[model samples]
Target: MANLVIASNTKAMKKLDKGTKDKVWAFIEKLSADHTASGLHIEPLNAAVDPRVRTGRVDLHFRAILFKIDDKLGDDPTFIYMGTWPHDEANKLAERSRLRVNPINGVLEGIIGELDGEDDRKKRTVVPDPRGELDRAIKSQPKSYLAERFSLADLTERLGLEPDLAERAYAASDEDTLLDIAANAVGWQGSALLDLATGLHIDTIREKHGFTDSPVDDTLDEDEQILKALEQPASKMQFTFVEDDEELRRVIEGGDFAAWRTFLHPEQRKYVEQNHSGAFRLSGGAGTGKTVVAIHRARSLALSDPTARIVLTTYNKTLAADLKAALLTLDPNAVIADRLGEPGIYVGGIDALGNAALNQAGNIADAAENVLGYRGAELTHNRTSADKVWRDVVQSVSSGLDAKLATPGFLENEYVAVILANKVTTLEQYAKVARPGRGVRLSRPQRIAVWKLVEAYRRQSRMDGSLSFPEILALAAEQLRLRAEANQGFFADHVLVDEAQDLHATHWALLRNLVAEGSNDLFIAEDSHQRIYGQPVVLSRFGIKIVGRARRLTLNYRTTAQNLHFAVSILSGAEYKDLEQGEESTDEYRSARLGPNPRLLECDNAADELDKVADKVREWLGAEVDPATIAVLTRGQTDRTQFVRALGERGVDARALDNNPATVGHVQVLTMHRSKGMEFSRVILAGIDDTHVPSAATLRAVPEEERAEALLRERSLLYVAASRARDELVVTWSGKRSELIHSEAGE
Candidate 1:
């Protein structure tokens, strides 16, 4: 049967009135079920540039324009471009449609071909060829850099542009001009050329576009090639059948434009469906679909092996819950729904795994409320009870007459970031261990003093009969490793971690020991640019090797170019690294769509800022953007509470995000920390000022030497907050704006 594909041009549908849209949906349903139904005249348009352009009647006054898919691939006539056209404009619309594959990214794009007329030429003189201007700019560069190292053939072969255009480009000037014109180039043609010239790997380029090394025979004709392309499961041109009517209706009504997850980009499918021998790491920037890949990979494993046990986890509860909900959606027919929660596939936060192990070992205290001696001292001032212990017990313990020892913050980090993180128990182990990333130095006497502090903290933790979250992870890891050595069975055969950057050092250790190091043992996806908690970890220390098994995804399917650019600017000055300690950069990252520049709202004071934010939100609601697609992000829980209350007072039914996975139907208010791994159509980052962004408490807690690290973490937090926006971003400030905001913005 021929397939029915919906072009990603959602704006075309949005331009119609509701009554017309409903009629259009009815037409599509009938066409998908049976294209030959009476009253549906599906015939080719003679005026179209592409021979495959066709039109189908929706009503006497309205029609649906479509592109015909080749029948040799399948007997069913594959139709795309489900745009409703008025009777008067049906022929004009069909004539404008053209189908072609982007050479750089291998995506099938439905473009409106350029029209030619004397009148049009006259109108175009106002804006000269932006490409010509670019050509002139690069003419000043060294001749060899343009003509010798790179050539016109390279551009033609890389971007899959017209031979005439490539010839014109080559005959014009230097390679620098070609590179300079990249921003002005139409569609993927210009962007891919620029990326190629700038040193992105060919493999990455092919992966981004859904191309594989195994090629279809070159002798195949155009129709045959297209048929082969559609047959491949990962092709962007491939169609997914929406069997469930209610689900189909929900997808259209909800404005979920990206289509179904079953149709994945080839690279994403490669990661999800391909099995690896041991460990694998996938890293990408915000909106790169890392979490989506993790979810699909879990389903893939379960389907491939009926007896397989899989655990899908992340750093926090909210995100894990999100993953579980998404995973459930993979079963469109409810085929595997019954097998999800047991020995088949398990999903939860990584911390829950530690708790489970602790519970199994019977080590955690069930009712030790007063054992730690911190229950009565008001722990709200610090980050956690552990922070208080570090300040009061660890920092206060020192040598000399008046306790004349080094500053205790350094010692505290030494114990946690280095010692306990690496399972260092003895003084000798602490002394000999190399602090590769640590900036502070310590002498023998200082080491003794710090070790003594560490010993005191351990003793107190034992006496309290309670363990911090990190300590639990460490103890669980040790217990699991011991069990593995003694030839014992583990909980899950496969483990997949999403948002791996936020995991603590001991969590990494625990994950490493969760199962024996073998086929499909661990798969982790993370981006250091989204690290809002804990410190960077060296994966080699935990025996997870990613030397040749790592992949970087640079194309962001979510977030617009405008919003993504602004979000990336926040981290441009900061350095980021992967779990394996390799330096990571986002210079090559690009977004799928272009949108309006993010709005920066500056108000007189805190109250004024809140009022302005509410006003803008009201405007968005008036514009008919879904309330569920809007979110308000704040720096801390207090700010979240304030914003939620203020928005509620203004008649906006806003709800603060909590443990529940679903956040639909109401405006969501959440802290930046809680906003990780979530995206929205519109986002408002409120109270992004100097004090609240970095949080005065966070700054005061860090040692002076590690202040830069603290700021970087804050910058990452702001970056994550800003990037969650898909189409629009509004960043507001009250008194002093955050330095994290790009200087060019708000002018």
Candidate 2:
């Protein structure tokens, strides 16, 4: 049977008119049923670059290029590229194109024009042209001063480029043109070369692109290779079959070629398609498609086992909603939708899942009254106010321990970061526990004193029916453990976790208990660089081991290069550890698109800053950017209210984000913490002045010994906010600029 596949890169689709798109769909439907249908005018071109290449006439002036699989041409033609081009140009493009399976990840890719210089040199027959300057420089040195001697073949293999292009790159005698060549290189080749040029480690580059030193299978026949290609998921392929008319309409209407819609990076696809013996995790920086992997994994599991019950969850509700929507978009047959919220598959916030599991086990009333300490309807009305309980606990502890020691904030840090974080309940465990990353040392006497204060606080809070978020999670985890001790089976067959960094240790424990330990038990997607929430629990603490099953994504598809550089600079100097205890940073992460630097505005005061913000919002709205696609974020809740009121006063329709809507005519206003897992086309971060950012209250609340961790949290918060902007970032501040902003300027 013939298959109609959309090309991996959909940029060509954006240039078509609605009438032409309709024609393309009609042709696809006919082609799917009968490739030899009359009036289609499909014929092989004599001058095509590759022997298997052919062209189909879309209309009088346009053409679609197709790459047929070996001798199986008529039956399995893959549409790789389509657009309005002159007949000669279309043929040339087809002639130059080459199809090869990437050795690293076993993915089939179509490339236009071999990277070798022979073909290009043929077009421009000027002998010893000025462009040869770069080629000549490399000839003189043979070895680069920045790194070891790399031959053309080595470069081609490492970058997955054709030998000619690699040769042309080596021929470059000047750095400027070589830089330009690196910039123009498409797909992973450009990213790899840029990283190499920027002094990133060779091993790091190889790992990022899924390159390995191990030998690949060189004996597979062409037929065998094509069969393998057919098995690969759409997320990892550049060319895909749209299959149905509804899917084709979605493709044309979605605008820019969305990777989320058509393809997945190899690493992401691996987690989706491959099964694990135990727990597995996918880790990467922002925009690396971690959530995309989690969504696909959920659907994949459901499709593989119809009787399987799957739980897809994340830390926050807004992100969970986003995940659910994306899952539905990927679900063409409604397989996931029909099973969602049922016994087959479930999707929601982790807290929601926890509550559901507790309710199912008939422990909800006791959990509400005892574990969470709520009375009557307060259990329903005041459920999400657990964070406030933690704050109140901090205040009470700070005042109680003030007379014993100068700064008592470390006690709160110890109680949460050490005790509650590790599920430590008894005072003996608290006194002997090793506080990694806490930076404060306490004698046994001091530990006892701190324990006395914390114990009193806990007892009084229990009497008052108060519980912090972490405490609730810990309690929930204990409930699950109790159920398990009674030999109760796990609630679900599989659990997939997104935004895992924001989750507390207790949350992981609850998740660990929700699914039985076996193949495909846990799928975690996390990036510590984007950890705005202060819960940094080691995964192994909850018996969730991912030693050899962890993967990292390096390609950034969301933000522009300039914007990424600025966002990364904001996170400079702070070290973040991943769930596996590995040092994580976005230092080597690169972006495909480049844009103007983010604007950093220094205003006279709050009034002037709000006026400037209004002007920027008005400009973005005028540019046809969707109002909902634009966001205004702040460091504090008070600042969020001020910005929301100011935007409303300026006649801009804006709403504070309690939840991110599917579509909106109003702008979103949110605190930096709330904006963690979301993305926007344009973002305006206001009120980041020195005093407001690391608020005086926050500083005074923490002991001097624990100030470094607190400061890093604030920096991470800013990094999260800045990274949420995909295309443009406008940072405004009044009075003294933040030290963090100054640090960014330095980077």
lDDT of 2 by residue, 498-606 (tens): 9888776568878988877889899998888777665477888788988798877766778876777777887777887898888886755766566567899989889
TM-score of each: 0.77, 0.82
For model 1, what is the alpha-carbon lDDT of residue 112? 42
- Candidate 1 lands at a TM-score of 0.77
Query: Candidate 2: which stretches are off by over 4 Å?
Result: 10-14, 70-149, 157-160, 167-183, 198-237, 241-249, 256-258, 332-343, 363-400, 403-471, 648-653, 660-663, 743-747
lDDT on C-alpha atoms for all candidate structures:
0.69, 0.68
- Candidate 1 wrong stretches, greater than 4 Å: 1-7, 10-158, 162-207, 210-223, 231-234, 237-257, 260-263, 330-343, 357-385, 388-419, 422-464, 600-602, 618-624, 645-655, 658-667
